[model samples]
Target chain A: MKYPQGVKRNQVNTPRADKEINYGQRGMTLEKDLDKTNQFYLDTKRAIIHKKPTPVQIVNVDYPSRKKAKITEAYFKVPSTSDYNGLYKGRYIDFEAKETRNKTRFPFINIHAHQVEHMRACHNQGGIVFIIVKFTVHDEVYLYPFEHFVKHWDAYLGNGRKSITYADIKAESILLPIKYNPRYDYLAAVDEFYFE
Target chain B: MKYPQGVKRNQVNTPRADKEINYGQRGMTLEKDLDKTNQFYLDTKRAIIHKKPTPVQIVNVDYPSRKKAKITEAYFKVPSTSDYNGLYKGRYIDFEAKETRNKTRFPFINIHAHQVEHMRACHNQGGIVFIIVKFTVHDEVYLYPFEHFVKHWDAYLGNGRKSITYADIKAESILLPIKYNPRYDYLAAVDEFYFE
Candidate 1:
């Protein structure tokens, strides 16, 4: 396996293709490493954060043994939402983690409608809600609150911009410090956003 | 498709296949419908509720097209905590939804230590915590508060019973009414549990 640079072996998929293949976007490198960091966080119990399961609409399974079954006829399930969430500190934390290698901007299409809605609801209910976006080229990560994202999302229909330029992200979002333990010390930022 | 006479279609996979099911262990069904119902509520502006996505550790994928890919290799990623969670009536709701077919009891094995710990943390934070389980044959659904379930869960680990008996569920749980719009009126039960 082509171990993606700086990823531990135990991570579910820490390897990249032998050669660079297009992911239709840039900077999957950031996505990989951050996931690795999150996995590390989960392993040590430094924090209890996890990416949601891949949605699969199981159609059939072939049980070779009574206890073992191979899902052979299952189809990909279309998710109605984003991919990551969990709890940190004493609050119910919900957010989606995405990365864009594009040095200029992060596409709004990367964020789904249901995800924004979920974030909005959680935010309205006073839960900690935000998104962690990694800009691979800049080697930077920002914790963008769902409030701003949703504001732009609701305005997307009337406005023409479909994404936030790197400049805008830097201006409106909290640039979280990358840490060794939690990797995404996001809750700290939330505290900053909450208390200070 | 057959509307599983024994178990509702939305509540598929009601625990083990070999045994008769109970009515008080229908958490799986309750979780799925609540997710949809929560979305319906969000869309209709009633309340914002959500069932968190399943936690997964994706290992491999088969990209069919530039825009589409199928997961070729993956595993049932270990989840670190509860499954269904959302905000309801300005309260944070966190829970693990599970169903058991065991005729006499709901197995403790159906839940993980992390989930129990998660519920504990949420409850300590003043977030409303509980679990939904359905007993199929009895066609009854019960909402077990986290406070109660955790006690039973730990007792089971300390050489007590392997599962919670039906009588215990009936006594300590709230029986949720079946509603056509949401299927399971868990919020109503939460109202009684938290407010009344």
Candidate 2:
């Protein structure tokens, strides 16, 4: 059955050419991969992470039938917090997923000011907060803690570099493993870095 | 300054007549009241609850300038889970808020099937789940635990009553107090009922 836009579906097909070129490789977008991983986590009763719905300013809606309400006019709003958050081992887990084509540095522009502030707020409230940085060219992912991001964020404003070098990320953050089913097992990195 | 459509602003003004008549009364919509309460919670370092932004499907966007990308066409999407979720004392808090015109009963139709399933999933993961019900006619609010809601929900599916009576709600749920700043201080009820 054809589903409406924004409905969650498991079997998302990537472009055929891309699929053929990247066979046996996790070539999907970071968000899609994370969604799969979160779904796997939920299904296995391990965690319950979810991407927050894209904020929208709705002005008009059309109801053609009792069962259907189609939004006719709306605008996307900037998110105030991270993209993903949920419960993990009875603790709140919040993080934003960002991908960079640059293999040497993760650009600071990939993140927003409000998101950093939100991470600080969550951390102050004793929640586990981090950022998932994906080096697309290198095909590597890292779970970088919010503290490290904040350090670089402040330094950039005070005569430091505009980006965090891959060397710094390697030194400070935990590397995530890419699996077939759960795709990006970042929570494993969380378990090692935060819990252990 | 003109703000974006969905940005939360504190100084929302209702009409003059409504303001005058409902003066000294919490006459704002359940959503507005909850937003105020959540803001209060955030400010006082009590909790970090946030209403999930309404989901939207973007069909088109126009970039008038390099920095300003305006969404030209989009549609709202139905939410799959509760309206509000956050952290309280290092525990996950998830809930939905609903208002009813009926003074006697709260119709189960106000909630969707997916929301019920979502609540169950959250509960299974050891998250604190509940529903905030507002009887607009009676000007009463209650924090009804998910367990209680589930009991009635299942009963309604199996030849039971179509709605939960106000008498039953009064006996089973914690009544929320309306205040000036926070508006609906439901967390106080949560503390007394769940943590106490």
Candidate 3:
């Protein structure tokens, strides 16, 4: 299985590999699926959502021509907010997506403190905030609202529980439909939960 | 005058140099001022605006330790949307900021076609979209709404006008206040125009 260039397959667990190992699914990663879904949403004029690009700090650039500038040296910078955000039904929609191979729990370590603070701030500003957790082992996806996630986050800080159990997530979150074309139809869940 | 590393001061007009030349203002660039304004907005719990980090395509990364990962090679990528966006008073706010050395007009060439398309899409989704145009030579900043900007943009395409005249901008747009703490206080315009 050939991976994309610059993708460190050994350092991070590749979603393609995880899909094949756990669910015998071939092709299409969670990230790729979500991108496709967002594109589809845009094309259909249903909603406007985008994944923010990975931040980079540039150290050097070479101007080979008047019109062309090429970066010679750079480094990736940690993102301060969620991966996805946009407008839906005149409301701000912001979310972070993550997948875990573990069947029983979604680990707290998967999310950064700044991301949590960002989510809280967005929510306070009357934006709709949520997290999409994919349990690759179970081949399931859950949309967990920021309001509920914050409670668990605060509880963890108080009690030292490092994860949210699958049971708790299933009880608290709305199940998102996985389908062709749009791939991950998470916005359907958004429509149902947020709009309704 | 030394410019920041990786920034080609010769290729494009630097805002700092423009400030020094035009207004004898020595310390702040439009970018820094907007960043401070966004931070002030966040701290005051007034809005949840953020400047999206510059995108980068990472090529190589080195993990010196189990927890430390360093990117060895990368290149900057063009962004698909506006720079700053978030929720303000339950409304989705999206915008791009640019500064020009020209005294009489704001060049249409300064903005990319993709950014115009992005602003149009956000506007279609009922989001409040605008551009912060700073005529550095005149030391004036205007908050130009996307609705009006699109008309001029379309007219440019139709009649080959390459710029929006300073007089037109002053007449059609809201002049944003330049202050000490928040710097470019554009959100005050948003509150007045969008909310009021």
Candidate 4:
């Protein structure tokens, strides 16, 4: 498994060392890592964030029993908002996380237009809105604040580049810390960049 | 259909007179009215609140083509958080909406324990948290602030009353005004009770 650069394996806490090794062996995905990180936050009472459920439009359902109502037909719906949102330290936090296998750039097509508009609205209303992009090929994750993200998005709307280059993201975004307990310590980046 | 007491039909504005008449004829539900209210808020750029999609646990899905992924088997999930949440005037707003046919009281069975805990967490974090209770028989809707709701919840936890009395709710909660454009003007109550 790929590890973030400059972090020695021995630096991890001894109690969670075995789990870290197991996580690496399993090849962690961005979604799985965020789930672990959010769970850790909840356990420690640090945040109340949660991943919103997958949006689905149910067409038919079957009631086999009093307690068992099974969805027989459904289709995924385009999400109108970010995947994760909650209150963090008295501030509203909202963000979308996406992973790309493309090594050179993060494409704009990964996010929906409605979601971008929603984030913009939230940001204007003083929410801490951001995007977490994971370049799987490089085993790196970066948090791009809404202010920076919208600049690129508006540029794209004006017939600019279709994607944000890897170099651009590396320079503009906050590189998240990887840890044993939380897996992806993105909130640490939040604390430094936003709350600070 | 039942209308809230002491309001003449002529009191509603003429611009939406036909629509309001149709809404009454069709039987307006709390969920439908809130959808209209939230949509109105969004259209006017007043707020970005949304009712979360119903949570479902998918057991099996089939891909018919590259474009269509059909969910074949799924089940409803007990929600762990409130139904609605968003940013309002820079503060996080979160609430659960419930409807009861009983005219005398609002029962605790309508809400799950996990949702209560989530609301408590948000409230403690300085978020504007509340509960919207619609008494169908009385055609009345009330917004109970988290602070007031928790008192009864704690009492129930201590083997006290299992439900909040309607008269107590009337005395403690804000009665939401039903209107033509927004349907239920709950945020007006928010503006008065919290922001004022």
Candidate 1 runs further than 4 Å off:
A1-26, A29-47, A73-75, B1-40, B44-47, B52-60, B65-67
lDDT of 2 at B137: 68
Model 3, C-alpha of B55: deviation from truth (Å): 1.8
Candidate 3 C-alpha lDDT tens digits along A37-126: 999999998888999988777778777766556666666677899999999888999999988877899999879889999999999878
**Chain A TM-score of each candidate structure, as shown:** 0.75, 0.84, 0.84, 0.84
Every model's TM-score on chain B: 0.78, 0.84, 0.84, 0.85
Order of candidates by lDDT, top first? 4, 3, 2, 1
lDDT of 2 by residue, A1-196 (tens): 8667533453355465765566325435788999899999988989988999987777777777765566665666788889999999888899999988787999998688888888888988889999999887788899999888889988887985789999999899988888898998888888987899
TM-score of chain A of 2: 0.84
Clash list (residue pairs), candidate 2: none
**Which docking category, incorrect, acceptable, medium or high, applies to candidate 4?**
medium
Docking class of 2: acceptable
Q: List-wise, what DockQ does each model earn?
A: 0.24, 0.40, 0.47, 0.71
- TM for candidate 3 is 0.86
Predicted model with the maximum DockQ = 4
**Ten-residue region with minimum lDDT total, candidate 4 chain B:** B6-15
Global fold similarity of model 4 (TM-score)? 0.86
Give the alpha carbon lDDT tens digit for every residue of B86-138 in model 1: 66665567777777766679888877777788777667767788988877777
Winner on DockQ (1 vs 3) = 3
Q: Mind giving the per-residue lDDT tens digits that candidate 2 earns over B107-161?
A: 9887888889888988988889999998876788899999898998998889767
